[model samples]
Target: DVAKGYILYLEDISVSFDGFKAINELNLYIKEGELRCIIGPNGAGKTTMMDIITGKTRPDQGSAWFGQNINLLELSEPEIAQAGIGRKFQKPTVFEQLSVFANLELSMAGEKGVWTTLTATLTGEQRDRIDNVLVKIGLIEHRYQDAGSLSHGQKQWLEIGMLLMQNPKLLLVDEPVAGMTHQEMDRTGELLTSLAGEHSIVLVEHDMDFVRSLAKQVTVLHQGSVLAEGSMAQVQADPRVVEVYLGE
Candidate 1:
């Protein structure tokens, strides 16, 4: 797998906040189209690691690369995003008053100065892509509905759909299933599973059962660095992981 050309490569990344180290000598990688799950306890540097990857937080040392050619550390936050990395925070941030379709349309990665109305000259190819994403996100029927009218799970999906409009190469999603019912969680799991093979996904989630259902390669972080990496069963049986969960 070393030769598959990883979409993301982070080596020896370290970062500190104030007097405390939030990330220490972290090394992580995600192969093209791989679905990876990250699980960790509080203060485990999960968010900080994402911040580093997205250029929101600069690491004290080490390198972050989008591919062999691009030096992620050299790019600004907006530049990194423009380079095909999209991140979804824990909370949904859709335009409540806009229609679902409008929300997705506004999230287009190109020049926002182009004006949402009055025909920004989208290619037939681009329009087709938007139509397809709407179907994939299960929002086709709700296209005309105000985003505020969608349920929580639907809102989450809309936000994800908005991210998809950017056509990102890698998506960093945090706590996607939080505040959802079991049915919503299950559907969300299916959606994420469906996303694999087409995109590389790094998911940070807490629901063990949901993680098991997705069953992608799992990485567990502790004390600002990687503590364990394996399948669910393998990590669950690790003495360190078991002890940490039980002790906390």
Candidate 2:
């Protein structure tokens, strides 16, 4: 039976690469509008799990669903993205030469040819949307600036703002605060937490302090499967997690 409140479901999923099981019978779920943090040591199958969800990799056994009726396994990568799933890798990939406002403009949902995108004019509503996202990402003042000149953290936020322009239902973020200063990390945490009620977020990070700052549920992955799921404190207290990850 399909679950009622979940925005994502990964059940009994497994994938192997060259005979090594990367994700083995992993089960994970995200409730609508919830922010979930995933953490694990290296080789813990975290990336593969994200791959499965985003349609970049298919599992050998089990199912992945986006919503009540959307079968994720049957969709192409672009199709999945069109269906409202967005992913941001650890590295920021904004258009360096373009202005921040222009970057968000090009990222808005729709099929646009290069010629059309270059010449198109924005409607009042569209401009408002971009402004809204700019505010959300704390980049309104930097809107007219070249993306290349922004700091590391600002680039990451701009990229996230670009994703928001597409109005995704779920976002998968990979190590967003890896190189951020403590202040930037705090800002990022605030931005992400603010987005949770409108869009479900699955954040994969190794920064335990940043994860704890979010104060959300945390999932610990080990050996290609979920080892622990609870609050940050709860998982830290979990002997299994400490032995495998935290203690190291």
Q: Please give the CA lDDT of all the candidate structures.
A: 0.89, 0.95
Which candidate achieves the best TM-score against the true structure? 2
List where candidate 2 sits over 4 angstroms from the true fold: 246-248
TM per candidate? 0.94, 0.98
Count clashing residue pairs per candidate: 0, 0
Give lDDT tens digits, candidate 2, residues 34-74.
99999999999999999999999989999998889899999
lDDT of 1 by residue, 123-196 (tens): 78777777888898888999999999999999999999999999888999999999999999988888888887
Q: Highest lDDT, which number?
A: 2
For candidate 2, the clash count comes to 0
lDDT computed for candidate 1? 0.89
